[model samples]
Target: MISLQEENDLIDQILGGKQEAYARLVDNYKSYAYTIALKILNNRPEAEEAAQDGFIKAYQYLKSFNRKARFSTWLYRIIFNTAISYKRKNRVQMESIEHNDRGEESRESDLERSDKEVFIARAMEHLNEADRLAIQLYYIKEFSLDEVAEMMGQRVNTLKVRVHRARQRLADELTKILKEEALTL
Candidate 1:
């Protein structure tokens, strides 16, 4: 964990005209930020674009950051909103394009991973967006319920319920996917 004092120092440096200091902050949070965006958007390229846009927005708005909250919490809210907006914009763009108009350039690369990892990713897609993000923030990023609530602008109890239901839904989806896989095998 970065000490609060160190984070404050970095923020102070960024605010004091050392623009390069912001890169340190970006490096520190980029992985988690990308994961959050990917969970929301379910597309690698768009998620990357959204994460980058979120960092840009965060840098632009740094002067307004409230020190009372954790920087991660504040930054994640921006990422979540940016990814949601990206998803909506992409949805619209997709609707306007003829199916044949989508070129091969937009295709995702076939990166290899474990079957279980792939299954988990698919199961996450089965979840409602809120539940998916709740699971990701609580389990994947290991943020506290209160922290997640603060980031999502929701009550802690509501997030707790969302997480519980998300877990159950994930379990069900995993079961079904595994069975289907077995049949194919």
Candidate 2:
């Protein structure tokens, strides 16, 4: 991780016409940017494209970046917005299929895990976009609420409420699904 001082220096160099300095910033934040994009788009190719596009946009507007916020917070907001735009533009849904090969004992465990994942995913579908994004960022990605709120452009309290409500909805949905499955069995 780059120190805030080092990050500021790099920004200074980039603004002073040292293009290579920007590469360091991209390298430092690319994974995070890609992860954000992936969470939003749920497609590898689209996420990669969105992350790259976000970096380009950041660079294009680098001159206008005020020093009030950490560079990452600002960049992530841009990446989040870019990924959301991509999601809006590409409305097609793609489902991923996974195949697991393991020892017999592990196979059963994997199957259980996979089943739970399916249930959770199905529950997630019932959430509004903001609630879903809040849950994913806060729980799955392990971002602090402050960071998630900043990246999502919401007040911290608003994000907390969304996360809480999302969790409640997910739990209710999962319970309903599990009970239905139990009856079928």
Candidate 3:
């Protein structure tokens, strides 16, 4: 925890508007801030955004920082909160793009989506690397079940179970979240 005296000193310097001091603050806190943001947003671009946003917010709220807590702890919470908001905003945008439009064109044209694979990276973070690889191979990369089995070094039946279980777990989690939200509303 930064002492009241230290915090006061930093705030005095910041309030005096030492741009270099502010940059030093950001540099000091950025790694942990970015990690917290990434855990929520899971997208590099969004993580970067949340980290940057958190820094700006920290600058704006510097005076409000509690001396009892570590400066990094307060900054971490802000970064986390910002990342959650960023994720929520992005989920809506992704859903919009995911919807099938009624006026679809040729199959080849249908294959060309405006939203890129970057969105999938965020969803993939919900799974472990193994589950993520299985999902990518089965869905995104278009590998056959046998190929997936070979890649995973598991029996075909085992691979099938893993895929099925992964899908079920994801659906169950989403359903639970939706139900909780519906109750809140």
Candidate 4:
């Protein structure tokens, strides 16, 4: 594997005149970029999109990247920031409306919701942004719980509780929806 310094040097070369050098850089860092995007966005198509955007940005801003950081590290930060911005901009920020106490169907039918988000993702949608992010970082993104806690800016125990509760809520909601669907048929 090429060292990050080597990669940065290569990028400098590419910007200098060896434009074909972009191919090598792309081959080297594309997957890493995509994974970071996926981790942030959770949608494969959106991940691909953010990855493409990051590559373009990297190319356009290659001159702006000082040699202070490792190439991959800087690239990772670019994709991470881009993915986060893209998600925030694209996401439908649901208001936390109170569960209607008197309107069972409203709440129950709402409970029937399932996002096209994967198994973990559908469950994740139930959580508010904080809980969803905590759960994704700790579980799906496979960050250590401690790492997740740090990233989420919360106590480790609090992150643990959030992950646990998020999972439970997802399970309960999925089961309820599945059972309802079965009865409807």
Give the number of the best model, judged by lDDT.
Answer: 2
Task: Sort the candidates on lDDT, descending order.
Answer: 2, 1, 4, 3
Instruction: Estimate the TM-score for candidate 3.
Output: 0.49
Q: State TM-scores per candidate.
A: 0.83, 0.81, 0.49, 0.55
Residue 167's lDDT within candidate 1 is 94
Tens digits of lDDT, candidate 3, 52-119: 99899988998787777656556665775677678778888856654553224223343664323323
In model 3, residue pairs whose N, Cα or C atoms come closer than 3 Å (at least 3 residues apart or on different chains), thus clashing, are none
User: By the lDDT metric, which is better: model 2 or model 3?
Assistant: 2
* Model 4 lDDT tens row, 30-125: 876787687777567889999899888888888888787556556766776788888877765412222333255334545665433334444566
| Winner on TM-score (1 vs 4) | 1
Best by TM-score: 1
Expressed as tens digits, the lDDT of each residue in 77-107 for candidate 1 is 9998898889887886766552554444223
Off by over 4 Å in 1: 95-111, 183-185
Residue-level lDDT of model 2, residues 1-185, one tens digit each, is: 79999999999999999999999999999989999998898767889999999999999999899899889889999999999998877664322222122244345555777788878877888999889999988874557899999999999999999999999999999999999989999
lDDT for each of the candidates?
A: 0.85, 0.87, 0.64, 0.70
- Per-residue error (Å), model 1, residue 155: 1.2
Clashing pairs in 4: none
Task: Report lDDT (Cα) of residue 27, candidate 1.
Answer: 90
